[model samples]
Target chain A: MGKHTVVPFGPQHPVLPEPIHLDLELDDEKVVRAIPSIGYIHRGLEKLVEKREFKEYVFIAERICGICAFGHGWGYCKSVEGLMNIEIPLRAKYLRTIWHELSRIHSHLLWLGLMADGMGFESLFMHSWRLREKVLDIFEKTTGGRVIFSACKIGGVRRDIEDSELHGIAEILRGMRDEVREITDIFFKEPTSVSRLKDVGILSKEAAVATCAVGPMVRASGIPLDYRVADTSGVYRELNFTPVTTDTCDCYGRCWVRVQEIFASLDMICQAIEKIPAGDIAVPVKGNPNGEYFARLEQPRGEAFYYVKGNNTTHLTRFRVRTPTNMNLPAMVEALKGCDYADVPMIVLTIDPCISCTER
Target chain B: MGYLSFAGTILGGLFKKPVTTQYPLKPAVLPEELRGRVLIDIQRCISCGMCMRKCPAGAIVVDRSAKSWSINRFACVQCATCVDNCPVKCLRMEPQYAAPGTVKQNETFVKQAAAQPAVAVTLVKGVTPTASAPATGTQAAAASAATAAKTAAAPQTTPPGDGAGHA
Candidate 1:
């Protein structure tokens, strides 16, 4: 056996978009064990609920992670609404689904770009991000903000997308499909790309279930668990969404699952726009919420958990978010073991860690 | 050998124009939903201070005495809560974003009425100017008692004339 050497990967690294430190125990060039230490970017966002009113806390929630901003805001509002027993209008639920699906597409595309960049495919990264800009343009034309769509409120949505605008969005997505498929086909079919990821970081179905992985991470491992498929909140069930899964349980499988899910998200958005019922976007939400409620949603990363406790006051007593990245950390550490040093970034990127969301 | 599959796309790109635009030289088209900056029409402002109160970032300051509204552009999050809550639709969100600057931009908009000559100000208590004598002690006491009784008897709805003082 070779002598072991320890190396600290990052509190800062080029491949990592957020700050996280990992200590890798290496025997020669293979990582025998990996230890992760977080909390570098913790901003105490959960504690801010004591100061900011519940209505305004949605803004803080949205700021949790730029990629999953809409999902965070919607999850927070859903928790508060559950606490207050407020049933939003049907149209608002449909609109929330449309925006949420759009956010999912953008986030997966962004991850695909970052993954390609991590694997030294700069041209693929550029193409992926270029296509992502069209989705951002759709967000701008509908919700006013590319990253933070301040549309979700406690009772319902803040604004409504007109039927004509919804059709315009569908046309844009349909037009972009061929380009997206062309770019992503390179990832799936290119021998070099497939070789780098095909068997790099294998997380078996048992290992994934044991680690309680969520999102594409678990789906790639052959478990058909998806928060959206089992969701009780929102109109995801009514829209007839299906979870994309594969049994390969490798880095490449994770990438494939995400790309397939992007197409699924596009179909869901088109379906939501088609079946959208016309009604008031929002009803007046009066009175302070008083109760404890736990809300969970399928974020682009995974299943995000939000718990809110209001004490009949404007300020919430406690607000907590269990981001998907946080839940997938154990799975990440498991996947990191027995991998070459060069594959570290690829394995980490497959998990799609949002350090800000986890630390916040 | 895997690179051969991408040859078609590479050749296609050779004929197509570059995707990126010369942003600095050519202005980009902005969407209507863009939340760029907050602007207020000073003429339509009622000095009610609702925008100041509702702002999550506390980036706005409304000084009724000065007849001025000011905002620190950098501090504004462009959430549009102020615009939605404004009693009159005077506040608007301009689609064009504020130009990036090294220095903080503080914009103070003065009401047109502020430039006019000083006139007799009306107080909610019906106080008026008297050159020779101030309000007599008896008259002040009577007015105070009447107001106190009216407040005690009524449910104390928001007074119409009281502006920033009550807030």
Candidate 2:
């Protein structure tokens, strides 16, 4: 704490939507350290998973966080399916990929809106969120929830998206792309935004990869390990997947990567619409599974890993989740260093840290 | 060139529409079976204890075999695995995804009539009712079901006057 003033960025802040406490050590205007203190919104997901039966944990997993609900649910189901050696139906796999991309689009747009808010660009914030509503509309129509999509299940999805709506939903996503493109252009064109963001919380390519800064943050540093594209043998191959990448490895670079990703996700949704197969939504799974498996999925934020161990009983023995935000926290803590005090919020916003996921 | 792009940026703000849709009054059109809260069609439940066994939250309990299902609503996460596993097709996850009450838990889902028995052979992968089941003779099954129906219909008060004379 030598020659540094300690200031607390709280569990509730104007800039950050997720509640997190960070003790910032500032030397003049630059940040020397950002020691984050978490555990504010812990839903005790791990403890609850122990009490609930393995199959029933899907809802509990979905409730872990509002933003990453679909990914958490998907991770849980995949883990259970793997333990049982249940080969998921092709239709379910495809449907799952659809929801995952949809979740990514909505989550990124939401983050973009929040980032705009941090810059005091209230209009831009509203505009991005306006575009985000279309994604939410589609989500509610398909799975019946705007945020927490409990659509994913043990072997497959719970409900089927009507084949009739596929053509229309595809059209809706395409329309959203136009607005997203316009908004991204605005964010880039705005002098205040660019001046505030460009070269502001620089995490180099080597740093990003070594620290496992994932999702858009890693891509901004030019790392091309996107699970959707890498997991092509599963469902990504059927759909067109364009990995969003950038070279700047700065705040604007992260923003651009997310903007580019929205278009890629829209393209994926269109491809899924064309490739959607006809079949039952889910296969009934029975008996207590007697094995352990880890399911890794590409969530919007980053890699979401679910480790499930089932005894020869109805209840799951051990259920563990390695959320994306948890992996990014180290990088986030590092990214905050050497940033201007006034720009500290912008650096934090760039990570799009879903603290609920971290605490859960 | 910089000024030209800056000029275009200034004009863009005026055209954009406001995004906030008034909550509560405007009303969000939620999805069907969206997990706002748990709803049970109690009548369809066979009280087979399937929901209790499969509950991830351990929120549901059944009493009086195939007769009543009790659910502690407070603890329920509304996973709907119980709805999925019900052999009777009686237990259902209803469209009402939310409710508000001061009392957190409910001791009962409710007592309701059981749905028709599942006739089609369904393959359930994990849990109970293993891969094998009682073999079926299509025609014999129909005839035996009819006879069992007649036996169940027979009254207990047989020949009341004859029983009185004997006493």
Instruction: Give the 10-residue window scoring lowest on summed lDDT in candidate 2 chain A.
Output: A225-234
- Please tell me how candidate 1 rates in CAPRI terms: medium
Residues A16-99, candidate 1: write the lDDT tens digits.
989999999999999999999999999999988898888888888898899999999999999999999998999999998889
What is the per-residue lDDT of model 2 for residues A1-360, given as tens digits with 9 covering 90 to 100? 437799999788999888999999989888899998898998788887667777677888888888888888888888888889888888888888888888889899999999999999999999899888888888877776788777887778888878888888988888777778889898888898899889988999989978987778888999986777666315887766668888998999989988888888888889888988898878888788788887788888877778888779977878898888888888888889888899889988888888988888
DockQ of 1: 0.55
Q: What global local distance difference test value does model 2 have?
A: 0.78
Task: Report the CAPRI category for model 2.
Answer: acceptable
By DockQ, the best candidate is: 1
- Provide a comma-separated list of chain B TM-scores, one per candidate: 0.60, 0.51
Model 1 chain A: worst 10 consecutive residues (lDDT sum): A231-240
